[model samples]
Target chain A: MERTAFQIDARDNVATALTELAPGPVRLAGDGEAEQVEAVEPIPRGHKLAVKFIAEGADVVKYGVPIGVATADIMPGSWVHLHVMRSAYDERSAHLNLRTGAPEDTRYE
Target chain B: MSRKEIPSLEELRALRWRGYAREGGGIGVRNCVLVIYTVKCAEFVARGIVEGCQSPDVQLVGFDGCTDSQCAVNLLAGLIRHPNVGAVLAVGLGCEYVQPERLAEIAARAGKPARWLFIQNEGGTLPAVERGTAWARELLDELRNTPRVPMGLSDLTVGAECGGSDFTSGLAGNVAVGRFFDLLVDSGGTAIFEEIVEAVGLDWLLLSRAANDRARAELRHAYDKMIAYCRSVGQFSVSPGNFAGGLSTIEEKSMGAIAKSGSRPIQGVVKISVPPPEPGLWLLDSTPDPNPVQYGITNPNDSEGLMDLISCGAHVVLLVTGRGSVIGSPVAPCLKITGNAETFRRMSGDLDFDASPSLTGELRQDEVARLLAELIAETAAGKPTKAEALGHREFHIPYKYQEKEARRADCERR
Candidate 1:
């Protein structure tokens, strides 16, 4: 069965997977000529997968805007979430709790 | 998304509805008699009045602070002058800086039916509740005949704020809003988008969307101030849920968040409690004043953000949440739209519209926006939103420092 992912912009090097994507050819729901990309790993729903190769320190484009920069080299069909990318503006984003998304040192009084 | 389709000018301008007309200016989607307590001390009496009335037409909101802050005063004044408030009753405990008579004077000047009394002077709670209830009922009965006027898209001011965002929020929820904003702006309607703190790391992209040089400069100043404020506070408005929902950073969230403003050229930056000078697409910057002593409050929560939008004279407020939220503002009718289809289905009772059809490429962005516009029209025609039906008339008026000291000085000198 064909899986789907959305490339928000034609300039985007990544697409947000609409469902858990296994290693296979996935259809594109966004604007791109290739129409599809082969997923090499499992991509979680709402998480991103690179639609094109991204070199280290390169910007990760989405919504036609650079959301962050690649921490290391990334290839097409690979997961493009926090590990591969980090925000330039906010260094604390990397420290957020995986489950609750809570930031470090957050205490309720 | 090919080139994201947008609604034509005709579809936007086609909306026409009737609403109560405020004599001062603007149209009211709901005419509720608001009983406002000037300080925390008067809360019981004011709330008692609203409860005794047992009518939804009468509403209650109050300031819990004893100290004087221009931001709080202006926010209250904005609510009073709001087209939705048919009449206002100001209640105060004699010691507070915000006097009940003064609040009444402000409302009366705005051509609203106004009344005032101090909890101290009215022999405390017993007589106060009795007298305030009588006054509220009289105003409610009198306000029933408020003249209705034909209001169209051009005559409307719509504001949008996003909360509980996920990946779909940007791809669908906010995208729908952006397309609708374009439609609204093209038709000469005013669209105000707030949460300047969320516009992180995209200053150039933001400034480039300005309508002119003046607007560009304004956006720059506001953006810089917000960045400094965020750095000082050490928070970027991104939440844990946002992370769990697949958002990576403030930058990624900002990219999605700003999409609610659509592709329209922003008119300029507007401040809290200040309405848009004219209108096209104005950005509300509620960031606190950049002073050494006070960073001030921008958005404490989704409800405060919604109130900030409502204070700017919005007739209808759109709340786009990727993770479902059931919040509603007191003055303006909040139309809740979700971008996640599963969240929409699970929380169907609370959420109003779904933009998720665009997420699967099942529907065009412009088409979803037209359907959303119909809901706006129905809401303007007095159709209560799910929030309204649930009686979620939430409000927040936290004290914040603004550059209104000079204005306050002028008021004192008068």
Candidate 2:
């Protein structure tokens, strides 16, 4: 497949999206390139892009350690977010709610 | 890292300071009194005590939980010993998952005199609040009696990070942070950086910097898994802000963002909620999927991520900003350094330190390092950070999900 959007280092698994793309409608270049791979999620701008088919129940690699896992089956060019990649701490985690500067140490003090 | 050949105070004016920026260990800029809670039920009482206290150094921080034994155990164990806390006051409800006395015992073990207050046992909220307030006041007075002992710069650990990032983050703020990291490392002081997501496309560079083949391979495997998992759901990990800021690809962002490490060799990697086991140079495994439940949510912004390091015991934080960040952690001092000269000019009052000199080409690398080292020394002795002075306390407590399947996965990772 011809690399489109984000380019992946030959040594890395993740690709950076060069352009914003809708799920299941974009064409790309490479061995696994698809004209419209079913998008598991809406890929945000400047985030990681999948170069090939990634299985669910697997680790999400960025710098190489697992960031999170795929909650469901995804195709090429889908946007990934809270719905697909679930977090353990959803309610008090600062990542979900942008406001409220409460500290993560939830002990009562 | 060697101690200053000969120490002198006048170096403060010459921008040449003795006992500043030692190599290996990261130095702290502030010594804080951490007021902690042991469980959810005691939160209000703890807050009342903190609010009524007269000491400006005490910071209120805690966790929330009812009876989940495991959760309470983790929160209490982590918060009480977090490095940012110089003195600790652990509050709890008598019947909470974690006992307040147990927390006090733990703190006492660490050689920090811990005061305990139980809301339920102490005659409910009002009585507990009254007693806790009076006790905290006494503790503050006791803490003040301890003289400020001069410590070496190498005795400090300063965490470096950036969030709410823009394109300039890599070019300006992050780079400055890297420079500061390098200077600290050379001096035998420790400077740690995290945010694995920012390393999406820079695996090769990180692998090369890895201390051993195991870490190098681990680095590659970790990034690959993140990408695969993200792609499995058909969603891109990139954000719109990155595109708007003119980043064409994740690789571009990764390369720029990783530069904040300032050419330091990777010592080792640590998991979330884990403090750097040993100082030197450490790469905290900060890669988190966009999921709120699996990965932590408290660290949405870069400063928040830095706060994690602070919890692990960083005495100070070098917060780099390209756009602008006014927030700061309560326990530790945050030295806000801006890469964008325009942003620095506009938010001069909100900023504690400026690295705009690098952008102007007027200051060389060593000169900036010398200036930053001086700032670190002064702040360490006892100076209020920009965030503290402005009362910019931004807190976000992450909520743990109860999905059976997800919980299983989380358990496996742990």
List, residue by residue over B314-368, the lDDT tens digit for candidate 2.
6777777766778877666778877666677888777776665654455654566
Q: Pull out the clashing pairs in model 1.
A: A101-B240
lDDT of 1 by residue, B8-88 (tens): 557557767888998998888899998999899999999999999988778888788998777888888888888899899
Give the per-prediction TM-score of chain B.
0.94, 0.81
Tell me, by lDDT, which candidate is best. 1
DockQ measured for candidate 1: 0.69
lDDT of model 2, residue A18: 33
TM-score of each: 0.93, 0.68
Off by over 4 Å in 2: A1-109, B1-29, B39-41, B67-79, B82-84, B221-225, B228-239, B287-298, B399-414
